[model samples]
Target chain A: MYSSLIITNNIHSWVLSLMPAAVTGITEMMMIAMIYLTVFAVLGLFLVLMERKVAAWFQLRIGPNRVGFFGMFQTIADALKLLSKELTGTDKADKFLYNLAPYFLIISSLMALAVFPFSENLQAFDINIGIFFLIAISSIGVIGVLLGGWSSNNKFALIGAMRSGVQTISYELSVGLSLLTMILLTGSLQLSEIIEVQKSGWLIVQGHIPAVIAFMIYMISGTAETNRAPFDMVEAESELGAGFHTEYSGMKFAYFFLAEFINMFIIAAIGTTVFFGGWLSPFGITESIPWLGVFWFLLKAFALVFLMMWFRWTFPRLRVDQLLTLEWKYLLPINLFNIVLMAIIVWLNFTIQF
Target chain B: MSYFSDIYHGIQTLLTGMGVTGKYFLNSRKGAITQQYPDNRDTLKMFERFRGEVVMPHDENNEHSCTGCQKCEIACPNGSIEIIWDRQVDPETGKKKKMIDKHIYHFGMCTQCGLCVDACPSDAIKWAPNFENAVYDRSQLTRVLNKPGSKVRAGVE
Candidate 1:
């Protein structure tokens, strides 16, 4: 009876010891969130400026140099102007949902950042099913787009929402399938576990031919899923006059804009996590430095984002029919065959080293 | 066999298309070709017949040749011209003469049509190349051509 009492006391002390660590962790998480928000705001500003610069370069004109030095603060000035502008609601619209949609969109996209593993130990939540959680949460953002479109009561907006819904849902399957192949090979759903598997080498390098093929499929489908050009029929400026958020104005519109950029960052971050090995050093030399994973992860993600931007500015918008055909006919068949080929190759140990 | 050849043909066509872009990519770096407008204003080359804002030239004697004629105000299609008349006793003749009190021209509304300059019988007005007319206040944009003590040019007076 005395020995049992002593054991309970020890257990109590252990629990007491863990409390400080838990409190520290909570504080750390709060700090990280604040950082992420700050970074996201800054990134949005950078993207707006970069987009203007890129568009100007493409059109053979200089853009937005008068606001601040080299137009760096132009977006900030524009943001201030937009913030002060009155958000006018249309007369004939579903007032509640129209008001609510942008918030939902921004929230859904922001939630996606929770599961994304920046490095081995640097994740917000190391959920066992992190990959699935990310995919699921990111997909919820589409609901916001659809609601925004439908509630606006405008025909163009409704059509845009429909197009976005169809495109995003359809392309999500290909993105999932490509990711599924990676998950199958790694035999893990946890993002950190996936990175651990790729410690010896990146999945893109280790899995060889199939990995490259899967990567390509993921990129193509991911681009479509993000509603980027040339798959951006939903927001086709020429056809649908600002598209799904056509009736949205002021800060409500800003929320949608923020959501889009955040979504882009989320996809890029997930891609870095899944394929390139989140926080895993290339040569295993940087493993000692825990912070290096964050560096590498961001580098890879930004590279992917740059590629996406390049694709956006370079490619012309695809026709709706052409886009669907590309997905259903070409990408579907190619991905299916690639998956089968990957299965066979993995089973046979037929490695094609790049 | 024909299908395989078609694939090759498609690849060739794609490369050919990319070749055009590749050439332009190399050329874009050589010269930006973009006119940085505000920065390069000093070197901006406007044609001599560019037809900018109208200016009423002032003479050294603080005299203006304008006889308070309202022809230019009538000729203006947009009603952009406004001429205010001030009666003054002539120092030499000791007779009351109609003088243009103040030509308050709002260049913001001016189309640079040169109609006002053309209608001036005294030939005191000409087009000025001072195009840096952007102002923070809309009210301040309405400019008085003749200074308080200045006079119109001697050529027509």
Candidate 2:
């Protein structure tokens, strides 16, 4: 149904008409990079502002209303302030790794952002192994945290890095397994194909209770993966000061901050893609208006992001031991059992659809 | 079984916490716990007994009840109150009486203890709830409680 509205293809052909093949390819890559960079910056600012506003509501206080109408420009102003700040670091720190750490995080998150099929023909990269690439790229951010912490030459930073390593390593299994559970029903790793399968109904509906269970597991692990609150061991300010990025300053610190929100968006976007039908309109209500798929996609993703933010505000930071216990003891076992149960259901051909 | 129960209870409590926060979040405008201080200045009311500052009330006639008693001066723990007195003849009685030349109140030194107000025999002073006491100059804080060209109220001992 969405085949006729192919905008990205048209743009590619238009560019190709004017330039040689290699030059056109290089130009397209540059344009895509610029687009992703802008999206990353805008999403980071918006999410941070949303977080502050959501936090205020939970605490029953008016938050960040003085800068712009409803504090719209608060993060923008904050970004400007961070830009002007001095890039300070420890005198005896490992300068190479410390400088390189934030790029690992930013680049990985930006790379993951490419595979998301925002709408039909709107995706920058449509890799056949899209979900696999996302899962792989997502894990690379932990290296950034590790390098940032280890190279800072501070004990707390190192401890935080270690905690992050342990946390990410364990929780990554849960994220992968949970998504793998859904992969059984969709039977394709390509994000577009997964959404295409969901044209009959969202995976959460078709896969029934097992999908719901997997979604819960995915969300819990996803929050930990992002190093957000309740799983914020990596930046436990009370214990580890500012954690892995403690020594980072100026735009260096901003890079880490922006990468965090972008990572959060990626997590939410993946959940939307796998379970909520990516950019597909609900029951094909707005399927004809293919451009509106971006709207549906963002709406679902932002809803999930809000849910994550709610988890952050409502829940207390998990004690380091409790964090592991919950992941290993509860999420992993349930995830394994759920995966088998899903296999049985799919085998029986008992999947429900609208 | 207890392990399962713990998980159940944990999820229950977590949901309960989220519910509370969610309820507040939805009605945040109504349930806001903080006041916009500068914005709500007109409606911001201090309690009647709120000891914001010390003031000697004067009538429309610009007459005060100080009577140059020096009781407040003695009672002040911080020595914030200073009363300069002069001997004057009562116009009607032709009797020598003590009258205040200047009721100097060093707000900078006053601790809002209300001791001076308590010690005023004629009930000349009381707390004024105008707490916005900031001033650029230190000298500006040392206020003369009694206005210039003002007289003591009649029928005081």
Candidate 3:
């Protein structure tokens, strides 16, 4: 299965052409790690800057335009500043776990980034059970939050970590079920295969009402999973005062911040791949330009990202009880019913295919 | 039924809230109410009645309208005004007259109450709208309203 998918242009093939099989394999692994690391750092900086700009526009303010042309270099400058700051830690805290927590969160997020098919032959890791891999890896991020909070020896951090644990555990259900509903439409867990299935029409279009409902549930749950605003009870500044990573400072603190934006990107990327066609041009107008698939993929992902940003700015944060109520009382039940409705539609052959 | 309606209304309210922000985002360029202060200095305009600082106007001849009445000095609540009047022989009149030696304004201590401006019998001082009053040295804030060698204009008191 993996052999046929290894095309000519990727790093694996390029490295194999240059060296003997044993040497090439090792070198390819190193090269891929370097590439993904660079992507992680670059994406973290870009998404932070994008979030700030979107937030400013929504609030009727011009945000961070002084650092560079339209503040393009602002997050870069911030990352540099964070690098130069002193790394502070709580004196009595569990130093080992505290140090390990940030790495755990960031690594899990970066691992999840592997399965997203950005364009044809562009994915870093195209595992067989791609969506399942993403779902499993994303859940691991909350454990990092838990460790960071509990090990900090601070009540606020502990409370935040506990909230995060509860939120992610509950929301993960809806996130999985919603994708499960779409899986019925595509009938494949492989992301590349999912895109191939959408050759005729996107899942959202083919599956129609049920897919839309699933997408909505997925977005709300995905946002909660990412620990972002409106669903951001974990880091609710009014209550927790910087939350689970509050005791962290400098580059260590930056790891948590960077992981957040990366998680957000992953959420948007999954939404793009599953609902909208991963890299399929709308109406195949740009079918001649295969490279343009990356442009369309990113365009759809960022549109969903912007929608989340819109949600962040527009809505007030939900109370802890309300947050749980929303997930348990509303989202989970609707999600279960939506899955049944989708299964029935698939059974009856009622999906609208163009 | 209420549960279904709750979900319906909840989504409707969320969409309505999004509409408000989306509208502003679309018109953000013109709708942003923030004023970029230093950047817009050239285009910034202050209202006519804005009381920023007390200023004594001197004509091109270096002559002022203050008749050394000492009314403003008496009216100032904070002792921000000091009038040093001395009996001088007026060049034209050749008679001993009360003339201002120094009109010291301790702008650092001024409350901008406009009382000094109001109490000026000859309307000698008025508010200037130049609000940028920062100074590195404390002495820079204490200003002499009358320029060196500036004399009272020859006019009816």
Candidate 4:
């Protein structure tokens, strides 16, 4: 199944041929990682700006429009301000873990970004276990929250960090379960293979009810995993005054901040690839232009991103007990039942045939 | 028995809240409730009855209605208004006249309470609708209400 989807079987060999033997296989992977880290950082800035503008619109207010035309440079200005800030820490803070926290978050999300097959030939390191890798690596971000909160030596930060840890663990079940439901349809855990499985039709439209249920569960759990609003008790600014990252300042704080938007992008990107057919043009409409796959892929992902933002602005933050109840009593059970229902549907041969 | 129904209601209410916000977001053509303050300054008009600051209106002849009675100065709670006056003999009537030298208005101290406007005996001072009162220097905020070279309106006294 994976053999035919290997886009760079020759390309990898070609790179090895051209490069000096001293430069090992890790060198090629490192090069890919370095190039994409810069790309994702730039992409992170735009996502932050887009989230702010969406939040403003939902509240019937004009958001930042001063820095540049429609506040286009607002995030750029914010990045500059964060850069110039002095890095501050408490006198009693565990300085090592305190500083290491933000890097843990940023590196994990950046790793996930590399696995995204944006188009047929677009992805880097199309790992065999892409979905499994994404689920496993993305969960590591919560450690940063826990460490940042604990190391700050602040009570609220510790409470926030604990809540974040608990929330991520519980919701991780639902996110994995939801994706598993879709993985049932695709068979292969490889992302490109999953996208290929949707060649007949997008999963949401083809599988209908069970697929929609899975997508809905995926979105809610994804929102929780990213620690967005409503589920954002981790950094609930109103109560905790920015939670775990409260004591961080300067470009260090900016790392924690940018990683958040990047996490949101990763969730949206996975949502797009799994349910909306990755880079496969919808209904094969724009199939002629292969590169348009990237456009279609981003368009779908951003739409889901917009939906997540809508959930943020419209809903009130959930209380801790209520948040836990939402996961344990609601999403987890529903996701479990949804997986079984989907398997039954697949066995019954009732899914829409293209 | 009611457990499933409770979940349904919760989902329903959540969707309703989203619908209201979704309506506003889609109707963004109506624009946000926030007036882009700096951008819309030219077209942004205050209400006709809006009172911002007190000003003594003057005609092209540089004549105003203040009799230098200091009524407005007395009415000001914060002492934001001061009337500068001197006694000058009225040549025509052969009587001493209390003519205004200047009416110093410290906009920095003003609360826009309208007491000064209400207390002016000659109707010389009234509220100006314009309210953009920002200034770089504190001294620049103390304005001369009586324009330079302006005298009292001929028969206002």
Evaluate candidate 2 by giving its C-alpha RMSD to the native, one decimal.
Answer: 3.7
Candidate 4 lDDT over B34-106, as tens digits, reads 8877888999988787988878899889889999989889999999998888999988889999998989999
Q: Which ranges of candidate 1 are over 4 A from the true structure? A: A1-35, A58-69, A351-354, B1-30, B45-157
**Clash pairs (backbone) in predicted model 2:** none
Candidate 2 per-residue lDDT, tens place, B26-116, comes to: 9998888877889999998887999987888999999988898798899999799888989999898899999999999999998888888
Kindly report the docking quality category of candidate 3. Answer: medium
Model 4 docking category: medium
| Interface root mean square deviation per prediction | 3.4, 1.0, 0.8, 1.3
> What lDDT does model 1 reach?
0.77
Task: Report the number of clashing residue pairs per model.
Answer: 4, 0, 0, 0
User: What TM-score, to 2 decimals, does candidate 4 have?
Assistant: 0.84
Chain A TM-score vs. truth, each candidate: 0.87, 0.97, 0.96, 0.94
Lowest-sum lDDT 10-residue window in model 1 chain B: B17-26
* Model 2 Cα lDDT, one tens digit per residue, A1-354: 123345667877899999998899889889878988997798899999999999998899999999989889999999999999999999989999989999999999999998899888678788899989999999999999999999999999999999999999999999999999999999999988999899899999999999999999999999999999989989998998899988899999999999999999999999999999999888799878888989999999999999999999989898889999999999999999999999999999899977
lDDT, residue B154, candidate 4: 83
Task: Give the total clashing residue pairs for model 4.
Answer: 0
| Evaluation by DockQ, superior candidate among 1 and 4 | 4
Evaluation by DockQ, superior candidate among 1 and 3? 3
Identify the leading candidate in terms of TM-score. 2
Instruction: Please tell me how candidate 2 rates in CAPRI terms.
Output: medium
